[model samples]
Each structure stands twice: as structure tokens, then as C-alpha cells.
Target: MKAPRLHIPIHYLKGVGPRLAGDLEHLGIKTIDDLFAYYPYRYDEYELKDLAEVNDQEQTTIVGKIQSEPLLHYYGKKKSRLTVRILSGKYLIQVVLFNRPFLKRTLTLGSVVTVTGKWDRNRAMLTASEIHAGEPDPGSKWSPVYTACSGISVRKLRALVKQAFIQYPDCIKENLPAAFIERYRLTGKREAVRTIHFPEDQEQLRQARRRLVYEEFLLYELKLHAYKQLKRVSQNGVQMNIDRPAVQKFIEALPFALTAAQERVVNEILSDMGAAFSMNRLLQGDVGSGKTIVAAIALYAAAVSGYQGALMVPTEILAEQHADQLDGLFAPYGITTGLLTGSVRGKRRGTLLRGLAEGKINVLVGTHALIQPEVIFRKLGLVVTDEQHRFGVRQRGALRLKGKEPDILYMTATPIPRTLALSVFGDMDVSTIDQLPGGRKKIKTYWVQEKIIDRVIHFMRNELEQGRQAYVICPLIEESEQLDVQNAIDVYTHLSQALPEFKVALMHGRLTPEEKEAAMDAFKKKEVQVLVSTTVVEVGVNVPNASLMIIYDADRFGLSQLHQLRGRVGRGNVQSYCILLADAKSETSKEKMRLMAETTDGFKLSGYDLKLRGPGDFFGSKQSGLPNFRLADMIHDYRTLTVARDDASRLVKSHEFWHADCYAPLRETLAESGLTQTVHLD
Candidate 1:
């Protein structure tokens, strides 16, 4: 029978049986395409050197015929040695291998051997580090080393790949357009893949790798540019005549003046809203940098323009918190506000939903409940979603569908650098509130060992004695099946017992809505001196009385989460402290803790975290709305990304470029990527 295509399952191949295919699947080599895509992690180089050319104390690999069987000698119980000699170019080279006596059978006389080791000048010997009983290929200077599994060896994998290339050369055909490749001076896809697998030298490998990396960036940039183009078109949106004088008056009435960055972003949002098309923008700010205030300004403009506005947050606690703050922030301008959440239902929900539909509630603040099928806006002109990474693109789209493409503003507290933010979310116009409000207290952070648990508690007790509250955050709400981390309930119970003089309480995900609210309410009211909880409190929890936050196993959380948790404290003018207690004692954990203690700048921490955890992990959960790129490294390959972005822009704007036949493959690739669904506001 004819051989199956490269896309066929690996078991159909010559040597990969069902058992072997299962083993190969673990290395992400399920199909022939996957096997070809599996690039080597590193390379081993060997130079065929003669004994006469080899230096006395230099590391080298030499291939020659063995003169005799390896002689074995033992010293004491564990020490053993095997001495062998090889003849190369009429010169004799002494080789000594320690502890591996099994080589006596493989290194027998008349057998060709390859030995690599450091030469010992005094003994005129080359102490063997690795010995192969075969003549090394003279033409090849390097050997590819792939990531392997338990059941697979390097030899078997190399042979399988060689067989694949030889048998199915058609499978590695170049698919990119010829003209484009020539213009960019890029190698063909076929040549690139071949050179990547087995390059003649470093220069060849470099050229091949460059082509693949650039292609990865180009594809990603195309998707991003397409999303941007599709989203920028004019839509039948709610056209607003923003009252500039009234808006300026409202800003002046606020207790604190708006920062320069905040004023500029507000103007940008207002300009977009007044345009005929819908406004799709992202408001990125650091923790406590006053992003909500900027969002409120946009909502106020919409409300005063005789249209409804809605702000969606991530958690109920944050929803309630924003509603309370917005109620006060906008109340002076006679702009009414309402709250809608999962907790508000039945007649209350019915009445709230009715008020929203009738325009009685000018601005509605809530969690995801704002997008429920039952909820309706009378004349929705603005929609703002906070902590945008926590929600999926589909969920945000559902919210937008509630109105006629109302102006959308997605807010995130994670402080990504400007370049990366633009590259990742190229579909949306970015506005950053880089400056925090003036006179904010700088939070002091410290890393403490687990052995000083009592001392840490005593310090917190002192803060509590002075009429301040504290937060004790655990990594888990309850015992986890996989991890041995501290749980909130256990920590709460221990704290309550250890400090009977002060009221302590536990809050976690398992608690009912009312129970959770009650615990948070008590803590907010200072009825509970210490609040023990998981990351539930990371979303914009405003408790100024809480001055101390002690996170147990802080290494378990992401850098942004840790920053948000630290933001919980230092809200007021009082000095705040964040103590991280890590017990894992590993280098990774120590580095994480040290980074937390060293800097309070979220942007710097984010870059550092991205460097440590790769773009896939750093972008956050799948719900974060970041595309899964298989090759692009946003941190390291930024220059390539910039070039590709420009290339995509140039192509998209050029009518002649799109009309070419070479654009066929680009169009096909884009169709399969689902770029519209991945990044859309309507």
C-alpha cells in the first residue's frame, strides 16, 4: 500500500507501532507534522581529530580503531577503571574510563571507537567522558539533541526523522508565497525545516531559525491587524454630544484633581465616544492608580448625555465596592447609579432590571450579572468592564450585544509595559494611567522565613492593638488534593485560637454569597480584626483600616496578584507593610519572593515575571483573551514582532497587495485562525 500522508497518525509510519506512538505522543509528536515541528533543544558537536593534532590537555572527540580490549582494575569496593588504546594516523592515544567496566565487550580489538574527554598531560591519556563504538561521521560537525522521554532514545528518534524526510520529501514543501519570500530574503519553508533539523553549520541554522521566527511573528501580526481593521469600521452606535463644560465642572467638583494621564485618557475616550463609530479602547493602569475614576468620568458623560451606562467588574465584592464608590462619586452631578449582581435577584432583581430598562438607573454597576439575558438597557451608550483579563472575549461580546454597539471600555489593573500592551491588544486603542495619584504612601515589603511565625503574628498584634486591622491571605481555601499549601480555614482557626483577644474570621469561595458578604462586611466594619482569605480579595478591595497583609506561601501567586493583594493595604495615609512567608525554599520561590520585596513598580515586576514564566503563562488563563502562539516570544523577539507588525500594516493598507494571488495562503491561514472571534467587541 502507498504510504499515508504526513498528516496521518504516527502509528501508520514504518517503525512507530501503537506502543511506540503512545510513547512518542508524550513528546508532542503525535503525527508526522508534529514530528517535523519538533526542533532540537540543543546540539552536540564532534570534530574528527587525529591523535597527533590533539593538544595534551584540551577537550576533544577522536575516532579511531581500538588496539586491544579494555583492561579493568578495581580499587576498594567502588572504585574501578578501564584502560583502552586507540590508533589514529599512526599515533597511539591512551584512553581511561572509570566505573564503566561494561565497555570491555564494546571496545574490543579492530572495533572503531569515538571518545570525547579532556586529555591528561602527565599520563598522556584522554579520560573518556563519552565513548561510542563506531566511527563518527566525518562530514557532520554537529548532532541534534531533542527533548526525549523515558521510552525513547536519541538514536531511535534521529533515525525515525531521517526516514520521514527521505520517504516524504513532498510533505516538507514550501507553502509561503515565492515573491514575498524573495522580497524578505527568507528561506523557503522546506529549506528552513531541513536546515533546522540537520544544519550544515551554525550560520545555516541561524538563517533557518530566523525565517521560522519571522513567519511566526508575521502570522500573529496579520491576525492582530485584521482584528484592528475589522473593529475600526464605523458602526450604528449611540452618538453622544458630550457636555464639555458640564464634564469639566463635574471633574472640578471631585475631592481630588485628576492626574495628567487621567485627563488625557478621559479626553481620548470622550473624543471616540462623540465620533460616529463605537469606541473600543482599553484603560490599563497600575493597582490604585485611579482607573475607576477615569472610567467613572466616561460613564458620567454618557449618563449626562441622556444615555445609560454599565460598569462590569470581576467579583461581587468588587462590584459592591465600585457601586458604593460610584454612587458617591457621581451623586454630586445628579447622575443616579444602580447595582446589579448575582446576589440581587427575585423582586429586587426584577425591579433593578426594570429600572435599568426604563432609564431610571442612569449608570448600572455590577458583576457578570449585568450581561444576563434578563437584563436590558433603555439606551445603552457606554459599557465598561474592569479587570478585563478575568473575562473571556465571548462574555464581553455578550455584554456589547445588549446595546447597539455601545462604546466599550475594557479596564485592567495589571501594569504591562506600553510596547507589549500595544503588541498584544493591537485591536484596541490603549490609554495608560502611568502616574499614581500624588501623596500615596509607599508600601514597605519584607520577606520572612517560616520559622518566625510568632514574631510576625506579634507584629500584626501590635498593629491591631493600635486600632488598625490586618489581612492573612492563604493560597488555598481548603486542603488541595495535589498541593500541600496552607488553607484559609485552618489558618483562620489557628489565628482565632491564638489571638482570642482579637476577633478573627475566615472567607473563601466555599462560603455562600451572604456568608462571604457578611465576613467581608464585618472585616470592613472593623468588627473582625483579622481577615483570612484566598485570592478572592485581590479584586479592588478597599479597606483603608487594614494596614498589614501577611501572605502565607506568597510564591504560589502571580506577580500581578501579589501586587493587587499588596494594594489592599497602604490605601490610607498610614504606613503599610507586606510580609511574604515562603517555605518551599527553592531558588525559584526565593527569586519570586525577592522580586516581590524589592520593587513596588508593577510594570517592572510584570516584565520580570514574563521573563521567568514565558508569554503563555504570563498572559494569564485561557480566559485572558490572548492568542496561543506556538513560536513567538513576546519578550525576546520584540524587534521581529515590530517588523512584522509594520509589514502587516503595510500589506493591509495596500489595495494592490490584497489583490495579488500570493495573498491566497495568507487569507487561508487567517480564516483558520478565527481572528474575529478571538478579539472582538461586537
Candidate 2:
């Protein structure tokens, strides 16, 4: 069926004008299609009760007779109130409106009206902002409640929404195939859209929600599968027949031995590089899991073959750190290393570019500046991205385009659950370094209440006296005087005054890039004994000397974030510790904190975190660009998502349906959803 065309201007719609159209635009609604797809955050139901059966304090709607006109009373100094007496059979209930004296003109005595609002039993008053005259219609149940601004009430939005639906076009096209819908037990698109706004009953609402949620997850999975297929078919990478003897010599010369897990993953990466196709792989490891060594080994192999390797980091601090560390490691093998960042300028940058283009720099480490047009490589063979989440698809592609489609290796410390990883990075093969390096000690964790903050500070001071550095993290930068949680600035001030003898540095999201770098450098060099910061330090910057990490209001952060913060202190083997300060009264908060205290394993913690808080907290829907499903619970809906993945994979593999005309609408829908734009499938 052809979709109906409905393109009426907002002003032409019933009960809407220029002023209201502008308000609707603020909510991202500009067209009829937009209004139809704008789902409600939640719904409020008013139970119907007879006037005689109405009791004070019970939230119910009742039909009653207004015995007296609402009288407007001014109660001194900009205070006003409206009161009306209503007769409900033998009982008389007083209706009160606060700060709304205009209701007196709208409501009159001797009119039968139905009122719905909160009932205050102790005061014998029914406070209502929504009161309609005449008897309530039995069919007028399950009112559609919409999100509204300060001036726009739910009733007003509801009326506009109802008009939109009534004027909605017929024959809305179904994007999914008939066979797919039947197998998944999903409602048709037209019916789902109609029922979601004006459901016949609760069951219809549930079915509509299920259909839409399934469609979203299905489309997302399909896009991921398509990207994976395209990458496998199109890209032809150089097979690196790397010298294994060189790799073995470097490993033997190392101060430490490689773990079995690390060795296995490195071998797998090497095997992929040796294959005809280009390697697009992810190296996932927990904090302190020695991933950098594996990466360095890969770059070393590439360098030994007279090819250049590029390591791109998200931050200048991380790039500098990588360059410094790699410079030390590669110097023994007579390999030249160069650093490139936004801060590197003039002669230094020009010389580095010249060295790279001349094949003098064997290993290059930098931030996104490495992908700049001016930076050229003589024989770029491998591209390694650190903390892959910070770089988007375009940035990664730009780096690959720099040299002959270099084998891409993306590294992430954020241990994603297997299910979520499939959806987020399904295009790449994943290798997890589950084992930590030998001799790395687990950081002891403690959850303390705010009352014992003074004692905690004393302990931190003692640690500082022993030549140890500490990290104090806050959720926000400046103090929101209204909010009770500690901010970085406020904590910095308090810590400075409390520990007047020690040096303190403050860093937050609001700081300038140079200022943040300076603050981080001071803390890294031990110039600052304590560094107060936000989650900006969650990744990249590594200070092995910082042995203490104290997170204020630990309950405010997600489980994965708390784990990432704790990972910062345990980098060095100096018996590090993490202290989570939280409110003791909240049992839920205590439970989440206990999860952090029990284990130091990030992969296990990620799974438990997903189960405890649900997958919604894993990537933070806003940050991950993943759809937020209304009906599908990440924890409970994993089975459905997996099923959808399997079905999508099968459909794509079997070309029988790929060329079918039935899929044209589905393809068009995918294009409209912006999924196609993100995944540039060839």
C-alpha cells in the first residue's frame, strides 16, 4: 500500500497557531510524520469513580454539581487562590486552585462537571487544574498524555495530538517484509502508529510498542551486518609476511615474559595480517592488561619489514606518552620514532613530516593530527588507534586512506559485553586480552560514607607522605550550589585547605585544552600531590605513581565508569587503592558500590553491570548513538536482539530476498533512518 501524504502546516492544524508551532518545533516536531512518531515518555491514568464513592486522598475522577461559583481570593503579596464548593450526593467537597485565579471565569455554579486531579484527604479538598463540564463519556478513557512545556499543559498537547491523528493519512507503508513480521509476531506499521497514539486498550499499546522496538533493533543489526559484509568483500589488504624471528628476539629481550593470552592474541593478529584481506580487528583489554606491549610488538614487526607504522591516540597526553614509551623500546632496535600532535608546530612538525615522507621515521605516534593532509608516510603498513571510541568512522577511514589501506588495529580498554560488542563493532574481528600481566597487584577498593570524609583525607595524606600521588574525582566541574554532590572546583578548594602542606591541581571539562594539559603534566611529574578532576581522566593519561583514586559520589557514575576510574590507580604495582565515597542510606547505591569492591576484572564487571543496571548504562545511549528502545529492556531483550541478528544474517546471506521488490521499501526506510549514511556500504 502506498503511504498517505499528509503535509499540513502546524498553523492550519486544529487548535494550533504560529505560537504553538514554534513550541512544537522546540520539541523536534515539524511535520505530521514527526508528530506521529513522537512517542510518549509515559502515561498517566485517572481512575473513574462515582461522586458518591469519592474519598479524600484517592486519585480519581468524579462527576459532581458545582453548588457555588468559584470565588477568587487574594491572599497578600502576589498570592491568589480560587475556591469552589461542589456537591457529590450527600457529601460536599471543596475544590481549590492555587495561583490560578483565572479558573473562576471559566467555571460557573449550577454546572455539572467532571474533575480529575490529586485529592488531599486530610484537607478535605480536591485540587484540579483540569475540570470539564457535563458528564464524563465512558468511551473517553485512556487519554493520551504528552510531554509539554511550562506554558503548554498536557491537555493542550493532547488535543493537538488528537487532531493530528484524526487528520493522519491512511495506508501508511509497512517497511518490514510480510514474512519477517509474521515470524516476529509484530503489528503492521499503520496499526502500530495508530494504536501507539490512540490505543483501543492496554494490550494494543503493548503490541504497538513491541513492533516498533523490534523494528529499531532489527534495522540496527541489519546495518551492522551489511557493513561487515561490505568490508569483507571490498577491502584488499597487504599480507604482512612479517619476520617472526625479529618479534621473538624483541620478546626475549623484554624485561618481562608475555602471558599465554597475550601471546595467543598477538599470534591471531599476525595470522590475520598474513591473510590476503585487510585486517580490521579490535584489541580489547582491561586496565593494566599490557595491551600497549602487544601493539608495540605489532608496530615493531611492521618497522622491521621497512614499513612505517602509525599509532593514533585521542589525546595529546596519550600520544606523547606512547611516543616516549615507544622511543625507549625502539631505540635498542635502531628504529626512529616521531610524535605528531596539534601542539607540535613549525620546525618540529615540518621535520617530522619530512622524516615520515622520507621513510626515516619508522614508528609515528600522535592524535588526530596524524591524519592531516600534510602528514604523509613513505610506506604506511599498519594503523593503530588507541581508545577507538574517541575517533569516529571518518577519522579512522582517513588514516587508512593515508597509506595503501593499512591493516587497522583499534584498541579499547572499555571491556564491552559480547552481545553489545556485536552490535557496536560487529564489522571488526575482536580479540580480548583477558589476563593481566604477571606481578600486577589488584587494587583494594573501599566504599565510604560522606560522614567519614575527614578520616579519608587523613589516610590520603598519609599515603602522600609515603611519596605516593592521589587522584580525587568529581562528577561536575563547578559547584551547582543547589545540588548536594561535590564538584571538582569545590573539592579542590576543600582539599587545598585541608591539606595545606601538599600541592593540589584542579582539572575539569570546562578548562582550556592547554590548561588541562598543564594541570595533567604537573600531576604526572609529581609537582602536584593530588589531582582533582572529572571523568576526563577516565582514559589515556597514565601516571604509574598515582596510587590512590577517590571518587566522590561514586553512586552517580555507572558501573563501567567506576571500574574505568579504579583502573587508573592500579597501573603501578605499589599496592594501589580505590575509595568510593557514597551516601550510606541508599541501599541501591551501596549495592552498585559493592560490585566495584568485589572484583577488579573489567570484563566480569561489564557483564554484571549490564545485568544489574541494564545495557542502557553500558554505552550511555546519548554517547553510543544506539537507539533507545521503549519496550525492549537491554537485559531482558538480549534474546530478541540475538534472534533478530540471526534472521538478518540469514536474509542477507540468502540472495533470494535481496533482489526482491518487497525489500525496496525496507531499503528506503533504512536510508531514511540515517543508518545507511553512517555505514557507507558499497
Instruction: Specify the highest-TM-score model's number.
Output: 1
The whole-model C-alpha lDDT of candidate 1 against the native structure comes to 0.83
Q: Candidate 1 clashing pairs?
A: none
lDDT of 1 by residue, 258-372 (tens): 9998998999999989977788898998888899999999999998899899999988888899999999988877888999888997898888888888888999999888888
For candidate 2, the per-residue lDDT at 578 reads 97
TM-scores, in order shown?
A: 0.78, 0.77
Clashing pairs in model 2, backbone N/Cα/C closer than 3 A: none
Task: Return the lDDT, model 1, position 638.
Answer: 74
Decoy 2 TM-score against native: 0.77
Worst-scoring 10-residue span by lDDT in model 1: 673-682
With candidate 1 superimposed using the best TM-score fit, by how many Å does residue 169's alpha carbon deviate from the native?
8.3
